[model samples]
Target chain A: AQTVTQSQPEMSVQEAETVTLSCTYDTSESDYYLFWYKQPPSRQMILVIRQEAYKQQNATENRFSVNFQKAAKSFSLKISDSQLGDAAMYFCALVVGGSRLTFGEGTQLTVNP
Target chain B: SAVISQKPSRDICQRGTSLTIQCQVDSQVTMMFWYRQQPGQSLTLIATANQGSEATYESGFVIDKFPISRPNLTFSTLTVSNMSPEDSSIYLCSVEAGGGETQYFGPGTRLLVL
Candidate 1:
């Protein structure tokens, strides 16, 4: 069984600043995928970014990037130039091949204006 | 990326009642999944709604309690039967697009069992 863990229960960042949310996973499979999802007050789940385990280069999407360390099984999300809209509950998820995803407890991000 | 929509954005039902939530995807997809998110909890996979086949449920979920139907490639429904206050939660439908690993999610249906 694969498990995702998000250590930070809550995080706060000022507008235009940067913040990083830590996530770790335990899996025996060598090929898998990691994802970061954001759920706002609207209750809409949005994909922030994703990283493939086989890829050495980390994935970056605009202001969001991930530090994926496969050996340590660590995948952290970094939000730069944070905006108020970024405030939400962020979740880290892991999935292998076409299987279902395993999600972490989540980190509540608060963007202070 | 695919656009997904769910019916009855929200509903309030009495205990022991059943509610059916619909999910529609704009594009054809091969994989569709249902997830449950309890208040302040992480999302948990309830089942995988496979077209033309029975849904595969995860551990802790049963077909009698959470029935799912996938009539076609882009449509699916989940019925929560004999609802109780503990059943109150947000249900979301997701689809795996052409990409094998990435999943697109619906807005989610909020159910409150009184």
Candidate 2:
């Protein structure tokens, strides 16, 4: 069985600052994928970024980036130059091949101005 | 990512009433899925719908409870039958648009069974 854990329940960061959300998982599969999704109050889930296990390079999309440590089984999301729009519930998910996705409890982020 | 939309964004229905949520995508997609997200919880896969075939349901979910319909590649629907308070949750339909392992989601239908 695979499990994803997000130790931080809530996180806050000043506007234009940086914030890192921690995520860890336990999976036996060597080849897998990690993803970060964001859901705002509107209840729409948006894909933030994704990292492939085989690739050592981290995935970055403008302000969003991921630090994927395959050895430690850790995939953390870093939001640089955070803005108010970045405030939302972030979820860390792991998937192997085309199987079901195991998601974490989620971390609620607040961007303070 | 494909443009997706769901009907009846939010609904409050009486107990024992069934609600059907529709999911429509802008382009033809090969794989479509339905997920349920309870209050303060993560999303769980309910079933996977493919064109011209029966939907594959996940464990803990049954076809009787969540009857799914996938008539084509661009649209799907999920019906929550014999609803109860426990069934009240946000139902979202996602599509494997970009292919690979990524899935894009709909806005989700918020159901509150009274």
Per TM-score, the best of the predicted structures is 1
Where is model 1 chain A poorest over a 10-residue stretch in terms of lDDT? A93-102
For model 2 chain B, the run of ten residues with the poorest summed lDDT = B95-104
Residue lDDT tens for model 2, A5-111: 99999999999999999999999999998999999999899999988899999999999999999999999999999999999999999889878788999999999
| Lowest-sum lDDT 10-residue window in model 1 chain B | B95-104
lDDT of each: 0.95, 0.94
TM-scores for all predictions = 0.98, 0.97
> Which one is best on DockQ?
2
Every candidate's TM-score, chain A alone: 0.98, 0.98
Give the CAPRI rating of model 2. Answer: high
Estimate, for each residue in B48-92, the C-alpha lDDT of model 2 and write its tens digit. Answer: 999999999999999999999999989999999999999989999
User: What's the residue-level lDDT of A91 in candidate 1?
Assistant: 97
